[model samples]
Target: MATATRRSATRTGRTTGRRRRWTAALGAVALLAGTAALAGPAHAMAAASAPVDFATHCVPPPIAGIPPIDGTTTAQITVDNAAPKVGDTVTVTYTVTKPAASNPVDLALPADIMTPTGKVALGGAQTGSVTVTGPKKNPPVPGKGSFPPFSMTGTFKVTAPGSITLAPGDYNIHTSYIMELDTPCTVITPPAPVSETVVATDVPGANERSIQLTTASGKPGDPVTVTGAKFAPLADITVAGRAGAAQTADRTTVKADAAGGFSAQLTVNDKATTGIVAYEGAAWSAEKGAGPAAYTVIDDTPAPPNSQKLNSSVKAGTLSMSQAGDTVALSAVDFGAGGASTGDLNTVTVKDFRGGPAGWSLTGKVTDFTGPGGKIDAGRLGWTPACTTKAGSPSTCVAGSAGVVGSAGATLASTPNGAVTGGEFTVGAKVTLNVPAYTAPGAYSGVLTLTLT
Candidate 1:
């Protein structure tokens, strides 16, 4: 008879494989449970079953005279609800007809001492692993013999409308006595064919709500326009912005119009840090619905030369503009006799989501450069504009001609009146400041205002 200590020693040889098996099984179980909780409401229920036979490789106890075991396991899978709705949890039963490998020792296996855990790989409409655990139900084995086959049950929720394919993966068996014996088995190469496919359909009258931000990035205390659509008509809604543990300074509750839409302004918290703020709107109903939009918070403090500022503005029914910062700083340069100092302006992004043929333009103007030595004419500043449209845009972005941009302002970029469409365009410019021969020697600053229409 093999002593308990000897059996424990033999188990040590497969420790690595056992650890991997349990980790995968537990992770799959957690993923399945989380996904199920997020599903909406289930549709009508149905039932179906399929037979699966697959080859497996099992690592037997490290007995001096035994080798690794290879065998076949056959099982039948039955789905209780084959056509579930988005939020419905479906039950599945797996019945085994044969064990992958038999016990190689003459140890008496007691009743209710054997437990089995199995895994099924999912694909298609959803992707993840589903774990099935069986209760301890083995009959007393008098001596060296085959493990009894048993049935296991598991459940998973359908998260979206599509076809999900289920296939057998791997499994493990544990028998407890003086010490526990774990046998890890892996599916052979060229995995078994898909066991079954279940279709998950959407709930009736489920309309998806959406939210969009006028500008996607801004500084603290900046006001952002939040627009929502496709909500329940006359629904009371609460819109909030959150960035990690911090919440926006402004939160609004409003009533949706007859068309199931609403608009409100949210102010970024004055103490908010730089990060992405997610704006979410929840509609009040028996079954609440929510939509999300994202805004990036940026630092607004002025830095040394070459530092950039971001700014953006959007018209309610037309074009939208976003910049990298609130201020743009050109690199400091020593003024040479009758020479010029130059730097590149930060890029500005303009997006047309209005789906119209009416075109738009961007222009910039600068205040006169003022310092201890007096003032330099704003007309001394000139720029060479450049424009690039995103691939697939219907509009042709025309760069503005290089010229002086005085207080009156100048066109940085524009689109033909008939070429406007839904797309994004970025505009930038190389700025040159003409220095007078006898200019004063103090630092000077000016404000550059950008406008989009």
Candidate 2:
């Protein structure tokens, strides 16, 4: 009986192993079916191709007898993808057929020199225009017999869900030789007969992110408040300001809140140009994550004062000057066979707040140096002046030439009358004193005065 029980247990174990294998196979199949269900259905639309003809009126180059050329051209347009979801990009190709007409005059059509650019009108679900451009692949035409056929491509993003129709519109052909010659061609009459259609499907929660700005205009060093919404929660986002041709160097990164929203601030660059700057926010993992807020950079230069007669009396502004220190001490030198001693003079600052166009000047005068060795003439003291004007100020400061600062005084710096916007200016100099040989040993001191007007 015991042996029989052992055999029975082995048989049961084999049966259970087979049952587990069968269950695992069924589970694998069910997982695949669930994945397919989540994917829904295939939404890709078949590619479409069509032919279009245009009755073009082209303005040809000026030759004594050559007038405008009215001709018919053929093109084949192919939509790479006719069905795209919202936020998807689609590419369309425009292939032109070589014209049979001969050149009116001898023309050298260099490779890639002839460029064609035009817009394709959109209808149906979208109401806007898409720009198309072709690479410079035109074969060199020694004396144009018939223009070669070429292809151009354009791409646009699907913004809305619906059927979008494309119709060929106006375009221009540009050729450069001795002078730039652009032939503007217009589609004549009944419009282009051929048109292509694209269907855009809606993707839930796609391209819903948005960015807003607190202010639309600012000057350099100004702060701009940026806010973002409808982004992924806790997502890392980068926000930046961009101009048409210039890019701002400022950017900030922040984390979205639990509600899929974020807020940050960015400062404008000091050298930013005046134009419409778009502040954009983007996230790497999010599709169509970029959103733009337009900001204009206004010219910070204050407008000129309006000329008006005031009924009340107005106080006049003032121009003033001050020195960093009261006195300048030269390096002590031995009197035995002396040559010269030099030291840096104290810095002098001049400020002009007067709102008028009248300019000002700064002068420096010195008294005779006196000590135990009698006195030294002030004319013996010379200085090389250095002048600097404040940054971003319209004022232009000119330093005075190197010369002796005697009792009569000498120019240290000056501003021209063209400086309508007064600003602060700083002046510095290196003072030198010439001592004769066999001079008596003693300490000398001199008083220097600076005057501004």
Candidate 2 residue runs with Cα over 4 Å from true position: 1-47, 63-65, 99-104, 142-144, 208-453
- Clashes in model 2: which pairs? none
lDDT of 2 at 368: 70
Residues 1-453 of candidate 2 have per-residue lDDT tens digits of 002112111111121100010000000001000000011112223224567787877776565147777888777655544555665545555567744233445766656555565556667776545555554446776774556775555545566788787777566565544454556566776446555777788997666455555544455778877676666788777777654234457677878889988888878674342221222254222253533333444333433577522121122244555556433445555656666667776677777764333456666666676555666687887889999999865678999999988777788888864313377899888877776666566555555555454
**True-vs-predicted CA distance for residue 99, candidate 1, Å:** 1.5
Which 10-residue span in candidate 1 carries the lowest summed lDDT? 24-33
Q: What TM-scores do the predictions have?
A: 0.36, 0.38
lDDT of 1 by residue, 92-115 (tens): 555677878777567777676666
After superposition, candidate 1 runs with Cα above 4 Å error? 1-48, 63-65, 204-453
TM-score, structure 1 vs. true: 0.36
Give the clashing pairs for model 1. Answer: 40-87, 43-85, 309-325, 309-326, 309-327, 310-324, 310-325, 310-326
The positional error of residue 443 in candidate 1, measured at the CA in angstroms, is 99
lDDT, candidates in the order shown:
0.57, 0.55
